[model samples]
Target: MRKNLLANVLDTPSEPRTDYARRGASRSMRMSIDEMAENAKRMIDGEVIVSLDPSLIDASFVSDRLTDDEVEFAQLKAAIEAHGQATPILVRPIENGRYMVVFGHRRLRAARELGRPVKAVVRQLEEIAHILAQGQENTARANLSFIEKALFAQKLLAMGQSKATIKSALTLDDTLLSRMLSVVETIPPPVLEAIGAARTVGRDRWEELKKLLAHPAKAALAAEVIQSDVFLSKEGAERFTHLCAQVKSGRRAARKPAEPERWSGEGIQARFRKSGKTFSLSLSSADAGEFGAYLAAQLGQLYDAFKKEKAR
Candidate 1:
């Protein structure tokens, strides 16, 4: 990768990027580009004209925040100073003359940091609905965090969207939509924020963890289990959930006043299943005395009918 980038740096006529080999790269430094048409320029040198035509752009940034380290920001700024913006950023027009970045936030920030006018390839988005454009943009570029999407869906829902409309707005399937909404609805705010961290936890797995928190005590158990990476790994969280369920079951069993004789024939069969999600119960009773009175009443009625016939 270094050799190929270095070669591109040396071959391009615009300027030798002193920092290209070390600190930063052109947006063409993108590692993959499977979605583009064959003719799209995956790479270019300092000489390529990176222009921003307002007619060809849209507004809105998918990644609204930058990391604390700002390593990408520093590297991007250095690269922009040396090579200029080789690739124009994707953007859409906003309220003022300014445009909102659609995809290249790092590049845009870096350009500003370097005090260079950012170059961006503008695409006209007049016909596309805002939410659809946002969804399409997300779908095309990268995956979203489950929580990020959950929040997005909730925002859309609050904006008067029907369930179907919200699903369409996010371009998510029924199962995913249901799960996302479940997370938003169920997970407590602080715990949800902790799970939203980009490093250790994941949205799908974290959402499952939230379900375990439905019972307050179990929720506290989950909170303790998820406080650190060793405890929050998928395997760890699952085990903790299982343990929580087990303890809960034990507590419930202890709380029960024992089954009545009707269901006690088999004596309360209870066992956990393999998936830890299902259980079974079977009861058989042999008590003729429970029906003794009914049998006697029927016999008495028959005898009375017989006496009436005899009288007749």
Candidate 2:
């Protein structure tokens, strides 16, 4: 099922680009033929475009934006102002006939700013499909940075979408999804936002950051650094480096482990110990081996219950 969905996403049709001269499209509507064709094909395969009131559009579904690029945003605004909106955004209808954007935030922003009607394609989509369309569209455009994509994956999970749904949306395998989620879940949103997309940064560096932040003191320092003027002055990769340096500057030795927890009831006794993120459980006494075997056999059931608990 996921394979089919992914294939459909990859082959999604696009809207054909209208000729500027023929359509009286703005001179600012500058795009290569190949780009235009690709956009058109994608639109054709995806959905039909229609002009709608900008006031009726909402950006509430946006969860992946890391930062706003003023200059780039201005350029987009200018193009839209001059040529009118060329490409339509995707939207899902809401209650009372309102619509929420699934993607094309910049275009939506420009439309709102210009006080003109925005072009959009309205589709009925479930949460997973909505996110998948957003991710795949931005991916094809090479717009979303690594961290932004990671954050989007995190957002999907927070919304109670399963890991499998996230994988399908982002086109990530288990290993990559694990790495991405690790960074997004561990690093605070404010810190990630301050770092601002860090387009050149990759998984390894983010993994390093995740480890550095494992220390509460370093994590606190990082939180402070992200808000500092010095941190704000830097761009993308530099911003990430600056924060990393501050967090790594003075590391302390690891703390001693806490005493193992003890539990006893009836003829059973159990010991639980924690070291960092890992935990261990052990049984002792005459029936200890047999009890351990029983527990081990029930591990699958335990895990299923844990998953159900988490889902709730």
Candidate 3:
């Protein structure tokens, strides 16, 4: 149930409005007195202030993981290196002159990894509010994962926002929001933790997952499928969805008779498991290696048998 502290998007609101409005191309615009004052304070503190004080800020909180898509990552990394930080990271002061990172995580990571000094505007707030604000602000701008967004929405709900309010805050399309909400409803705590741990699961998969919960063991089976790399990648995540449907239809057909796999060496292997109308063929990497050979031999024999029977 523990979260990876290092993967947190913000220890406080990551992209606080001031954090963006005061920096980059927008810096040219006129500002209110508070903005002017903050700017003056920063200049006075020296152009390059070292406030690594992580007191009010949460450095332990991690930025979201970078996507594996190389092109986009390359573009982002290059842009940050060339332009320096176009957006000021949000931070809050801590007790012993420390600061926590709230937003601008991409910039922060780039700076840290590249040995560039990070530019930030240190803001301050209470710890609980800071934590709450952290999720609230970033979820607005970031395309958070289904679980991340839902869990964040739940957090807001705990903070006394109604579902309608949370919906508005998230700005999801109605159909999209409805589907996601159903997922949060069916998934239990342990599964939730798995979901939070970068597991590739969400609304689409949940429609199938929900079915299994009606029969707990099968639900557990579906969960195992989710945790499998082969199924996850090969068939796409919707594999579980289809598998669930198959299980349901198969279970219903159990009361009726069904065709049998003919007895033979490869056919025996193909008849690994059959329940009701649903059946399964067991396979292995080694077996898969020889599958084409096995299929050709077995199917050829069946064809030859049919030809002789017709001739007679």
Candidate number achieving the greatest TM-score relative to the actual structure:
2
Output the worst ten-in-a-row residue range by lDDT, candidate 2: 22-31
**lDDT tens digits, residues 124-143, model 3?**
55644455455566676555
- Which of the two candidates, 2 or 3, achieves a greater lDDT against the reference? 2
TM-score of every candidate relative to the true structure = 0.45, 0.63, 0.48
Q: What ordering of candidates by lDDT runs from best to worst?
A: 2, 3, 1
Which candidate gets the maximum lDDT versus the true structure?
A: 2
Q: With candidate 3 superimposed using the best TM-score fit, by how many Å does residue 193's alpha carbon deviate from the native?
A: 6.2
Give stretches of model 1 more than 4 Å off. Answer: 1-86, 123-128, 161-170, 199-204, 217-312
Q: Candidate 1 on 102-218: residue-level lDDT in tens?
A: 656566666656655677655445423555656556555535555666776776676676777667757778898888778777766655554442423466565655666676887
Give lDDT tens digits, candidate 2, residues 55-168.
Answer: 887775757777767789999999999998888899989878898888888899899899988999888887778888887787777477778889888887888888887887
Backbone clashes in candidate 2 total: 12
RMSD of each: 22.0, 22.5, 17.9
Higher-TM-score candidate among 2 and 3?
2
